[model samples]
Target: YRAFERKYRKNLKALYLVHPTNFIRLALQVFKPFVSAKFGRKVMYISDLSELNQHIRLDQLCIPNAVDEYDAQLLAKEKKPSAAASNAFQLNSTENGKALLETQQFGVSLAFIKENNGGEVIPPIMKTCLEYIS
Candidate 1:
């Protein structure tokens, strides 16, 4: 950021940061002196994914899986992961690179994935909260 601020700062218009950690916040504090008022006003800090959607849609960016992991924790804060939350769906693979099932559950539903031709059905209480699947 410091390097870019010195050279290409004028070329930039708006800047958005996602899930800024403590270290990033500290770095920005240190960098405040170097950034000019005009450019500094354009800098925006996005604390959550939904907030970022206002500026740029999720489809526009290829967000990493690690971001999702941080998201769950961010929402719950200090609460521990419940049993249902921990295993809403179990992922198995035909190959190491393969994902088992793609599910998009709206309202409420269950996900029953049978592997190796095994006759396993989901229990009545196995409702899922998954909104998207890929």
Candidate 2:
């Protein structure tokens, strides 16, 4: 583990423990101190591949999982469409159409969050956005 750290030092941004086996989890825990000391607070644990993908940046080479409600909320907030612009452009201009298209693509890409049946509730606009992205 130290050797791995030495080789990848500073270049490592996040540590992903994917559905780790018990032994691996234990090993990870043992190395947690070292990792934290080396990488600071960038470690994140994820149970699903999609969650890992979404949380990690695109340039990091991980394909995102379908967006969840929380993810949708963040994306919606980040890419929220301006109501005034929506009315004026309405997919008519090339740029507006492209922006709308990108938002829609991201929305649909997150649709799977609706299927996960957790007790967590989702908002209507988020659902609509997910459908659009899909």
**TM-score, per-candidate, Cα-based:** 0.48, 0.33
Poorest lDDT segment (10 consecutive residues) of candidate 1? 125-134
Q: What is the RMSD, in Å, between candidate 1 and the native fold over all Cα? A: 14.9
Query: The CA-based lDDT of model 2 is what?
Result: 0.58
lDDT of 2 by residue, 18-48 (tens): 5456787677679777665655465566655
| Cα lDDT of model 1 by residue, 6-102, tens digit | 5576677788878888899798889888877777788789888878888887998988889978976787773666676656534333234545444
Give each prediction's root-mean-square deviation over alpha carbons: 14.9, 15.7
Question: Using alpha carbons, what is the TM-score of model 1?
Answer: 0.48
Which stretches of model 2 miss by more than 4 angstroms?
A: 5-7, 33-40, 57-134
